[model samples]
Target: MPRKERERGAHQREPKGRKQRKAPSEGKERLPEDKPEANQLKTEQEKEVKLKSTVVDIDSVREKEESLALLEAAEQEDGLKNKNLGVFEWLLMVFALALVLLFFPFSIWFCVKVVREHERAVIFRLGHRLQGKPKGPGLLFYLPFLDVCHKVDIRLRMLKVPLHTVVTKDLARPELSVVCYYQIENVALCSAALSSLTSVLQSVVQAAVRDVLAQHSFSHILLHRRRIGEKIKAGVDSVACRWGIRMERADIDELFLPVELQQTLATEAEAKRQQQIRVSSCNGFQ
Candidate 1:
């Protein structure tokens, strides 16, 4: 009986240390068998996440490097700009100093003749003549802001005096032109007595022309144009003598009227022709 009870008790025995293996027909869940595959999958997923994090860190480092590189390049560019600006400033200072050295000394040497050498200054001061003081072909000093220098011929000077036209109380227009030759005898009077040398001569010559032409009729002025120019020379000689100038000659080279005067003459000739025609017709009809 005991032996039969022991055998019966085997079915109801308490399961001790070993877990029971489920039958295949009971459809057991095999969690332990699948654990290693899950662990391998987890390792692969972790690896992928780590790889993504490493890639992100690498991109961040690259971006920071690029920013640093760009900043360094910008600093270099700014450094170059500042360096060039400093060099430009230095060059400007040098150039300003050079201009002062060149223009100042050269302009000073133009005034005040060292007359032992016999060089003269024809100084024009404030639009007025200096009158007889010779300027320097040598070194001289002038009040730079106020004085201008012109050269005078120490030798014989020739000035062309144009011809003259006479318009008397009668309105008979005529041709006129001439030239005058003169030289500076006194440098002091020549410079001091006149503002412009040419102007004084022009005024004097014009006055002489008017005077001589006023004395003559149109035909006299036209025919004796050369003589009138000589007379003008005489007048200029007298005036220039006061300023220590010598008039070598006054000569008339060309005598002519303006084009409008020539046209008037032509029209007068046509009128004369028409008059003759009328006279001939009147005679024939008579």
Candidate 2:
């Protein structure tokens, strides 16, 4: 072939079986620097995506940790509250029991009594309907539950028995008063005589006084009151002997007329005195 034809044929028909690599033409040449720049841009974009994912993961972990800490804190707070409640219950129970234990001893003295010396304590037993024998001069224990004990003075007792005006046999009213003395004799009879002892004593005294006064006039009760007292004492002795009481004295205190009666007496005395003076003057004139 001619030389130009031979060059054209070589350019068009690549070497057989082995691919021919052609050098780029000058007008369409690729720059090696641009390839490296593109690779760096792609690597930078990948790094940015990875950084965003890491940030998300870190925030999630922090949130989880915070929630767990809060839950644990709540659990701890609940446990502390329960512990405080248990301590308060224990303290309250202990205090209540201590108060009960401390108060038991004082009740002994408040509900019981011991018999004393130089006195007789009469025991009133439960369900017996009768007073028990009088206990004297010993360290005797009283019943704390079933019996009550009372101190009975063995000494003589003096009481005032008053005398008063009554409708006399002479139809006159006289004022009077009296003093009396009495003592206990038969303890059993006295205790059984009446449930109300003071009332019983008053009844006996009044009864004696009424019986004795029935026999006397008003002047006898006021002037000769000594005899009246002796008679009253005798009457009282008869009654009190059975009631466990002994009569020692019956004495008068004061005797006076009522106001209306006193005025009448005074006016009558004045009129009688005036008449006597007039009679004396007339006799002297004659």
Candidate 3:
């Protein structure tokens, strides 16, 4: 019985020890009185975050303002430089005017040009073409040292091509000389487009003649001279149009046949003449 009582006492002591451990856990639970302190700490942290964000935003705004100020300063400097350049140009104009007035008659003689009715003038000022139609037919005044003028003849012109040898489709070689009549339709293109007008026209005419004549026999070229000439003219005209030249006419000026071919043609003509004479005599006799 005594041992059983001791066992009961041991059980009662173990429960007390467990109750003591649980009591500390209850003390560790969240308390209403401590909630206000926790809330205050949270509010303080939020305020710190807001302050940091506001500081960052202020720094960005300052940087933007500084960049904008730099840009504005650069624009102001550019505007000032442009104004200075404008003033310099105006001063130069005034100085040029005074010089022209000082030597009035001499300036007129140097600056004034007379363009004939058959001519047109293209003007270049400060190395740039003047943006308009060509000037012509009267007095043309321009700045003496600052402007350059090119006077082009706008009338009809004749170009005679030198004798060029060509082979016909029948394998007969012939020497041909051509005469080309042309007029300048656009003076600006004619003057500025070609480095050597005469040479270019000469080459064009020779090429056209060779190309057109090579497609026909020698006899056909002689018999159909007009048709061949027209074909040559059309070929030259197509290329000339790009350079502002209008081909008025292209004609074969001279043609020379080989000695053997000429002799053959003469003998053939003589035979035809003899046959015609014999026929006529027979008719008379009848």
Candidate 4:
């Protein structure tokens, strides 16, 4: 190699090295000016991060608030339910207490009996009749344990006697049913006098009907039914007076006979009517 060529090469290599070193130093010097932009960029990035974190925190707070609201609403609803139940229980207790208070005193202290205008109350003490005749048509009071009360109807009452097969004076057998009208004349005596009132009254009426009917013939019974009824009324009234029962009226409601007797009576009536018709025709011809 020539000496000059070696020197020239050395100069060229030194210039290249100087250029590479100068480039790195210039880059280092420029870093100071670029620091502001870098700092601005970092600040912007920090602001974005802050904004994202703030948004997340705000969402978390909103979720917490919503959950709190839901919990509060649930608590309020439970509170309302408890309050309503308390109110209902209190009302029921008050109503029941009032009922007990009102009913207990009325049941224990007062023994009130309501008698209608057409009714009379006969008071009996220990199975014996009381001194006063009978309670009025209004209200009456009686002892609960020792006294007994019997209500008597002062209005007109009707009783129907069962069918009685009676043998007439002429030996004709007929079945008879009767209706009797009676009113209570003395309320105390009527209830106190008879052990079995309705049964005894019925039996007496039946006996009176039998006794009265046995004295009359079948034809006379049919002809004078009203007279027979009057007699029955008299007999029943006489027996019923001791029981404070007065017979207002008695009537033979229905009468029945055997089929053969009915047919015979019907035939006899028809024959008599035909004979009358023929006699009238003969008189007209004459």
- Compared with the true structure, all predictions reach lDDT values of 0.64, 0.64, 0.82, 0.78
Off by over 4 Å in 4: 1-109, 266-286
Candidate 3 stretches greater than 4 Å from native: 1-98, 266-286
Write the residue-wise lDDT of candidate 1 on 63-182 in tens digits.
676566446544533332312235654565466546545776664454344433433566655454543346655765555445566655666666665555556534655555667788
Name the candidate that leads on TM-score: 3
Candidate 3 local lDDT, 5-96, one digit each (tens): 99999999999999999897777775765888999999999999999877757567756765664465445333323122356555765777
How many residue pairs of model 3 clash at the backbone?
Answer: 0
- Cα shift from native, residue 36, model 4 (Å): 99
User: Poorest 10 consecutive residues of model 4 by lDDT?
Assistant: 76-85
Residue 9 lDDT (model 4): 96
Q: Model 2, range 1-286, lDDT digits (tens) per residue?
A: 6999999888767663233243443323466657789999999999999998777675677567656644654453333231223565456546645654577586345444555554666655442323345666665554344456666665677776456655566666666666777776555445544577666666676777666777777666777888888877866765566555677888776777867779999999999999999999999999
| Ten-residue region with minimum lDDT total, candidate 1 | 76-85
Clashes of each: 20, 1, 0, 0
- Per-residue error for 127 in candidate 3, Å, reads 2.6
- Ranking by TM-score, best first? 3, 4, 2, 1
Tens-digit lDDT string for candidate 4 (1-286): 6999999999999989999999999999999989999999999999999998777565677567656644654453333221223565456546655655678777545567888898888776545566655787787866565567888779998999988788888888899899999998877666655777778989999999889888988889999999999999977876776556789999999999856699998999999999999999999999
